[model samples]
Target: MRRGRIDYRMQRRAVLAEVRSGVRSVGDACDAHPDLVRAATHVGAPAREPCPLCGEDDLRLVTYVFDRKAPANRGGRAVPRESLARQHERYGDLTVYTVEVCTACHWHHLVESFQLVTRDTAVG
Candidate 1:
């Protein structure tokens, strides 16, 4: 696919459908079927969209995050209530992304902005 041709809305619908089916948790489903993740997080813009840094209209869609990612519950210790805010501060959310390389300058760029569904929000 050219990246520009993917439909994000439709892809999300499919994922949501699976969630409503009670077949598997969203996390499990996403792990098993990464395509859903890809579709939900894929970024697309005009063929000649300008790069944010270089302002060149040749930038391509790279990668993205679909939902939010939770912080790693380290060491099996119960997290202190005071640390909850820190956890959120440390890991804002789950994200998916891709890299775009400049053909002319060989400059590589990563686009990471897709938010992932938090563990709290998603099923276990």
Candidate 2:
């Protein structure tokens, strides 16, 4: 794939989602994708869905993706900043959303949103 051919959005979404869920350690996330932490910290989160970074509500969903393996076509993928687009082709179907919140504080700007379609994974 060409340099720009890779999908950075999906890559970052996968990484960020893992961090937000606590499934991936911050240190591990950083170690695995050094650029991810830096990019995430710098770029800020999206404005849709709940603010994953600060858990705020006033946000907007910008980028929405559909889970590739989703049985009903509704799946969410966590993505980080640095690993965007080029992370992997397997992430083709993962849905990623970029949101922006309306908080005066510059600290809280954007967040990522994900949805669980199935009951088993949604609640579990």
Candidate 3:
């Protein structure tokens, strides 16, 4: 299959709809790995909405930031949404991904992603 930008909002809605329709169980959907669980628990921000997977209120939003100039092995960093402006200033060309996770069931999904740099700036 061809790879391209993803419409995360649509994808999230579809998954949630499936859950709501009883087509899929939240427990089954939440199959997060140990490291992902750890990151979401420690670095993620608490979300206002409940977990779509398990209907738990312990959902968190974990953000990962990436830049072209950053080292391959050490580029992605979990950061807070409030710090995006500062990160954008520091990393001229950056892509940010916000993922929602359920601490209760290890359920995770990408909430959103976007380029954080100004349009005039050159990205490589």
Query: Which candidate number maximizes lDDT?
Result: 3
Model number with the top TM-score? 3
Query: Model 1 residue 122 lDDT?
Result: 39
Worst 10 residues of 1 by lDDT: 74-83
Clashing residue pairs in all predictions, respectively, total 19, 29, 1
Off by over 4 Å in 1: 1-56, 64-95, 118-124
Clashes of 3: 1
- What would the TM-scores of all predictions be? 0.26, 0.26, 0.76
**Can you give the lDDT of residue 108 in candidate 1?**
37
lDDT of 3 by residue, 1-124 (tens): 1112355988888887887789988666788777777888888889988876667898999888898578888758888777888888888667788888888988888988777656644455
Q: Relative to the true structure, how large is the alpha-carbon lDDT of every model?
A: 0.38, 0.43, 0.78
Q: How should the candidates be ordered by lDDT, best one leading? A: 3, 2, 1
Give a tens-digit lDDT track for model 2, residues 6-34. 33456557767887799876555334233
Error of model 1, residue 57, in angstroms? 2.7
lDDT by residue (34-86, candidate 1, tens digit) is 33223223433333454333455654444433323334452122233234344
